[model samples]
Target: MVTKTEETQLDRLENQVDNGGGGAWEYLCLIRKLKVRRSEKVLKHGLSILNDPKKRSSLGSEEWTLYEQVAIAAMDCQSLDVSKDCIRVLQKRFPESKRVGRLEAMLLEAKGSWAEAEKAYSSLLEDNPLDQVVLKRKVAIAKAQGDISGAIDCLNKYLETFMADHDAWRDLAEIYVSLQMYKQAAFCYEELILSQPTVPLYHLAYADVLYTLGGLENLQAAKKYYASTIDLTEGKNTRALLGICLCSSAIGQLAKGRIKDDKESSELQPLAVAALEKDYKQRAPEKLSLLTTALKSLKVSS
Candidate 1:
């Protein structure tokens, strides 16, 4: 269902078409093409409209917004020259706009000017300390430059304000994982689980972290979280099943210090192994040898 605002816009587009406003009709078609991710069409139509000095000038104040749109579409189409042309026009028109500053920073980054892009982003942040767009760009620039520590710091700062941003948490966790900082990654996954306990990916990630940081205690926690993942995904999670096998094997190895293994431990290992064997037979027969090797490495009999 089209919303009232979109209906109004469509009505205006129809009126433009009726009045022989070919430019408006073209612009509407360009927007629709963009909506459907037809980047080539956007570049083709946007360039044709932008190439006309009369139509471009006639747009007046609206021209800047059109320039920004065309600039982004051109960038998507790898037409950097056209994109830069649009950006240059916008820079001249909106010299003091922070939004324009961001576009300049993006253009700089796209041009492989890492240092200049970072500087531009920093300048933008200084001008408006709460600029989320600039902050995000700073994080991206840091990551692009292989400054993982700097990217993590920037994301942490962002999360201090936007604590509920799951994507930020996930990004930070992935960076930590890249650096082999499993404990730190686990902390991020913990936050995700605390806030969105029902998300299977968060549970699986947390479980994987705990398993990677393995001691008997951490493995036990990993087993429990992997169980949660399996439950959340209706037991169709192959990775969770494998995690259960590994965790159970590790726990069984640790059980020599105790009088006997716990009841869940006694029950879970057989079930996980059974499920894994069944899945291997049905979906991935070629991987059965690899699965057997992994199970053997964990001292679990297949």
Candidate 2:
């Protein structure tokens, strides 16, 4: 696990490299380790090491990894010429490598050659049917080609085999949400929760979907999930707090008769309102009056 101190050191190394100091290899490795998207910086500093014979040789077998890194970074910055040079070096060394093949496909992708890229990725998948990266690249190709339905289909097929792939589930869920398919999105979130129950994000997302597909039962369920999020975050999540207030008020409205069991929602509303008021007072005093007015309006309507 990367510590806070390691992260601080990366920052310091970044500044050091920027000042024309050495440690180019250290800085580049740190950026890759942290998965930081300093694309321009990567291109600038990475080439510095690659261009110098001594520094390049110091990496030895790791020189290939640096080539891959610089290639991807160059593509990100649209410096295709540099990307091609780096990729050629890798291809010469690891000609039959699927990893290098992915780079070639990505270069095709960068040049808007969607058809060629798709073909390249498909060939890669044929050799290794369960290749997760290649599968995702296919989905990305569909998206880049403006084929939303195709992207959805690709993602669904990808999920059938890669059921444990939470990132794929998230992408599919967002696609469903974008198309206003709340129930489908809700199902995706449910899968995510089952896969990782302790993650507050899945709980919060499921709550939002249930709230969107609203009824008394859904609102009540949404409130419970929002409350769970507050508990998980130790009451620091402002949006989840607001969600609780909204769900409570909506439930209160739906249960107008204020039946015996429904009294909890009536009480819940006040607690959520108090939490909201306290949060706004501490975080954004300027917005407190507006929040109060909004709460009062909800009360009046109910």
Candidate 3:
């Protein structure tokens, strides 16, 4: 009584099973089809067949592949409980398989069981201590739980193991900046620049930290970095350039006050005026007027 369309659908479902014979992808596809058709009896049959040890011998070379497909499908469906059960079965069947621990941890994380997730990740790290992804995940978890010190400890451990990771160094620098440790952040940014001189964002971060530290001695250096950032980024960052000009004007004013030489102070006056005019054009008139007065005072003093 089935129509041609219904018959075709059933044929497609049957084809999903590897009669050649038996694999994880085949079983997973069959299960998905059964689930979609609401065939509870068939779905239960499939599950029972998967759980039976006697059927393993009959499953041939495709048994492990079928099992992995089932695990992945369960995870994709957000069926954490099912995924965990499948992973446990896999570990029991293949105790020496290296991916079981990772699968178990991923399922635990999906279920928001943080303590169990930590234990699983720690076990992985203990086995493979040099895995950067595992180390970064641990640091992220610590930071998520508001354990900044713990995150820093993890970062320090990672640094001790592998000192050349520019990404990790940038992450640590951002963390320090978040904590308002400007000087430490500046030092970290310096290290990052040494590792990756071409990354404009790192240069911008370095300039921001220098601006925060309130020292004009570094203003010229900050300006240079900001200019480099703008040039390398193809003039795409107007805000950074504007910030640099503002800071430069302020530093010029400070320099004029500090230096006793009239000629040197006079030289700073024109640079400060130019910076102020650029800032004014960028819609920062208040700071622009302030710098204009500073430039006028420098010219009169000279």
TM-score of each: 0.71, 0.85, 0.57
Question: lDDT tens string, model 2, 1-302?
Answer: 35569889998998899998888889999989977889999999999899999988988999999999999999999999999999999989988999999999999999889989988998998999999999998999998898999999999999999999998998999999999999999999999989988788788999999999999888888988988888877777778888887886677678875755456655766677787788889989999989888878777323
Pairs that collide, model 2: none
Taken over the whole model, the C-alpha lDDT of each candidate is: 0.81, 0.88, 0.68
| Poorest 10 consecutive residues by lDDT, candidate 2 | 257-266
lDDT of model number 1 = 0.81
lDDT (tens digit, per residue) of candidate 3 on 1-302: 24347557656655554333334334345445444442332333345567887775577866665565556556656666666777887899889665776777767766767798899889898888777777787887788678998998899789877888877888888899999988888988998889888878888989888877776667766766776777677655654655555565666677765755346433543443464477576877667667557545544322
RMSD (Å) of each candidate, 1 decimal:
8.4, 3.3, 14.6
| TM-score attained by model 1 | 0.71
Per-residue lDDT value at 173 in model 3: 89
Ranking the candidates on TM-score from highest down gives: 2, 1, 3
Off by over 4 Å in 1: 1-79, 85-100, 257-259
2 or 3: which has the higher TM-score? Answer: 2
- Can you write out model 1's per-residue Cα lDDT over 138-177, one digit (the tens) per residue? 8988898888899999899999998988878988999999
